[model samples]
Target: MAYAIIETGGKQLKVEPGRFYDVELLHEEEDAAISIDQVLLVSDGSTVTVGRPLVEGAVVEATVMQHRRDKKIIVYKMQPKKKTRKKQGHRQELTRLMINSISVGGKALATA
Candidate 1:
């Protein structure tokens, strides 16, 4: 199997074609196409390519499946002696991305 490491939303992730991953929210509409060029490493089964900072001409293409929010979590705080209490709930915005292809030098090496 071929895989590549990409950086997005201030984090690095291992990505492959035909797989879906939930990443930090992207400002694109559902079914929109996006290309990520911050490839750090690519393993094409037989050879590996590591970039100095980012691989030149390397890109990972994906489609935005949906925009959703993560499961909510509760936060609670209490002041035992003062009889003060606080409670909060939070949810993180996320986007579901389906990897479509990985390419180098404008030639796709893997596809969904």
Candidate 2:
């Protein structure tokens, strides 16, 4: 079994093929193809490899499942006994990705 930790959008994620995750939105459309190449660490059951920043010749391939917005969040402010109130809402832009494969030196890793 193999797995890798990769960075994107200033965050690191443990990823493997066949799993899905929400990441920062890309300019591509739904069902589009994408690749990520910032692998930081990789482990293959018996051995573990860590990169200084990123492993050379390592990459992760993924597919864009869709573009969507996260659930809206409400922000509120109130002043006691002052009849002052404020409300706000926010939604985050997100891209849904289905991990296709993770490879080091162009070789796909076995499922973890």
Candidate 3:
């Protein structure tokens, strides 16, 4: 029941150990380790800690699984009487990560 809210790739996510998540693309080799310190909130079942902007000494560890692109989305536009039309498709780059652990003040709070 331990979890933390972290900021990355201009987004906030609720994460827990042993879970896989896809976020904005990361320029790292597969299997590379990374630690995120932009923790906004954390809960360890018994207590909760909230940060003003970011929690001090709070870190989340993860490993890069792979890099991929998300499903394509289409955009279409048309004009009446002008016969003008446009169509476009776009995909977002993403990175897959496996959360390994969550810690606070150098003490492990959750582990995969």
Point out the higher-scoring one by lDDT: 1 or 3. Answer: 3
**Global CA lDDT computed for model 3:** 0.97
The models' CA-based lDDT, in order, is 0.95, 0.85, 0.97
For candidate 1, list the clashing residue pairs, or say none.
Answer: none
- What is the TM-score (0 to 1) of candidate 1? 0.93
Give candidate 1 regions above 4 Å deviation: none
Model 3 per-residue lDDT tens digits across residues 40-82: 9999989999999888999999999999999999999999999
Shift of residue 38 alpha carbon in model 3, Å = 0.8
* TM-score to native of every candidate shown: 0.93, 0.88, 0.98
Model 2 TM-score, all chains together = 0.88
Among all candidates shown, the one with the greatest TM-score: 3
Q: Is candidate 2 or candidate 3 better by lDDT?
A: 3
Among residues 3 or more apart in sequence or in different chains, the pairs in candidate 2 whose N, CA or C atoms overlap within 3 Å are none
